[model samples]
Target: MKIAIAGGTGLVGRALTALLHEQGHEVITLTRGKPKNARHVQWLNGTLPLEQLEGIEAFVNLAGVSLNDGRWTAEQKEAIYHSRMTATEEMLRIVTQLSTPPQVIVNASAVGIYPISTTATYSETSTQRAQDFLGKTVADWEQKASRAKELGIRTCLARFGVILDTEAGALPLIALPYKLFVGGTIGSGKQWLSWIHVHDVARAILHAIETPSLEGAINFAAPQAERMKSFGKTVGRVLNRPHWLPVPSFALQLALGEKSVLVLGGQHVVPDKLMATGFTFQFPTLDEALHDLYKS
Candidate 1:
């Protein structure tokens, strides 16, 4: 299969691109900068390179500004929102112009669309949507991505959970305090965290691309959802550190403002769609994931 990936230089994009190459698929990366190699083609801020993207079989849209780049100021929030909307819109434009539209499109999404809850467990079927900043942003983002379906393209909105990785994403920062022996529960420690290993995240995206019956919102979370307290303990245990000190909610709120929800609040999300599609998670358990990332 020939796959075209927007934002293919990002964290998850990089992993997915590598996996696709390993599986013997030709990959083309849509980029904003100079083409790094034969596999990369510049898209935004220039004419669409129809010749370069011809015969692409699958499109994975992962272009977006990082939410963790800085505090969620009004300008920063606008950048976050517009970045995703613009990139996704560009992808749609490119696909519409293609002589042969891709068979499938896997657009990046986030589980933050689900309402933050400690008791309520959410799956792909859950209709409840969140109203917070991040929640609203994700909700709108997914809606825009869903436009691909109107073009008769099989669209899969991959609602990612907290992606754990050793060098990038959230794990390194989450494990920092643990490495210093100051790690502990943040806020009330009751917030549910729906997390998945970065490897599993990439694999799930590939699965979505290949599965014909899979469409709509698919939670890219692990089967097991852990609360912040237990997640902290696992981090401590894996790092051979102590989970003692506690970071207060006010502290995070003051530091992060509206963005503190990333840590101080969460939802219990499960990958029901992935499970039904017979997708197997390499690190289903948090312990296994942490150990593989830290202890391996």
Candidate 2:
């Protein structure tokens, strides 16, 4: 199989790219910068070398700015929105122009599209879309990515949860406080944290590509969703540290502005669509995922 990946340098993209290559698939990275290696192709301002579009079977667009980079100012929010929309639009445009466009298009989305709720459990079929900034961004992003279906291509929107990897994402920051023996829950510690191991994230993407029946919104999350308080205890247990300090809601809000919701708020997202299509998760439990990631 031949795959083209946008934003292959990101946290999730990097892992996905490596996994694809390990599985004997040819991986081509589409980047805005210079092609650093033979497998990399440069695409700028929605422009790409048309010759490279041939024979690509799968197109995965993970191109987007880091949401947790900093506080979500108006400028940063626009950048976040622009980066995702433009990169996805470029890939879709190239796909349309290709003589043999990819059979499947797997896009990166977020569970944040579901409203932040403790009591509500969301699945792919849920019609309730979030009206907040992050929710709207993900909803619009998925809408744009959905255009590939019009061209007779199978499209899968992998709505990611809190990706748990030791190298990057939220794990390190969450574990750092534990290492220092000051780790605890944030806010009321009751908010649901829909999380998945990074390995499962990569696997889920490949599953979506090969599974013909999967052609819509799929939550790439674990089977079990944990509350912040229990999540903290698991981290502490895994690292042999103490979970005994609470970071107040106001503190996070003051520090992260609106972006604090990414941590302070969460959703109980279930992978109903993914599981229905017969995709199994490598790390379905928070304890199993944390132990695997933190094990020496």
Candidate 3:
């Protein structure tokens, strides 16, 4: 299968590209510049002008602004929205022009799409749009992916929570305090966090591609969900450090500004849909995932 990955320069995109390539699939990277080879194409203005994706079998849209980059100003918020929406909108237009449109379109969404008010586990069927910035952003993101279904393309939205890797995503940020031996919980440490190993995340994506039954939003998270405070204990145990201190929500808000919600307030999301579909997770427990990541 030939897969074209937008935002192929980022962490998740790079990992997915490697996974697909290892399976002997031809992977094409669509970036900001012009195309230089068959495996790489440039998409300026967040869209391709020609029907370059003529015979592509799958399209993965991972192009979006960093969710934890910094405080969201007026401009940053717009960039975040434009990046995801514009990329999906463009993919729709280009697909309609294709000689044979791609069979599947796998897009990136977030668990933040679920409103933060509820402490309940959120699956694909959960409703009620979140009112916050990140929540609203994900709602729009999924809507964009849902559009691909209109053209008879099998569209799947991989709604991710925190993805664990050595230097990518949230691992570095979460490990910082632990490295300093000041690791602790955020707020009451009761916020539900759904996370997955980098390897599992990549594999699940491939699963989505191969599974003929996959459609609509699919949560790419670990089956077991834990409180933020307990997660601190696992990290501390893995690093053989103390986990006594606690970072209050007010302190987090002060430090991270509006982005603190990502750290202090999180959903207790579950990959119920993924598990029910007969997909087994490699690292179900947080300890197993943390030890593997820290040991390596």
On lDDT, the leading prediction is 1
Candidates 2 and 3, the one with greater lDDT = 2
For model 2, what is the alpha-carbon lDDT of residue 296?
Answer: 39
Tens digits of lDDT, candidate 1, 178-207: 999999999999999999998898899999
lDDT of 3 by residue, 1-296 (tens): 98888888788888898999899998888887666677778775645545556778988888888887767778888999998988888778778877888899999998888877436878888886789888888888888789889889999999988999988788788888998999988788878888888888888888888887998989888988778888888888898889988888999888878877887778878787678878888888889999888873
lDDT of 3: 0.84
Candidate order (TM-score):
1, 2, 3
Displacement of residue 3 (Cα, Å) in model 2 is 0.3
Sorted by lDDT (best first), the order is 1, 2, 3
Best candidate per TM-score, number?
A: 1
Q: Which 10 consecutive positions of candidate 1 have the poorest summed lDDT?
A: 165-174
TM-score of each: 0.98, 0.98, 0.95
All candidates' lDDT scores?
0.93, 0.91, 0.84
What's the TM for model 3?
0.95
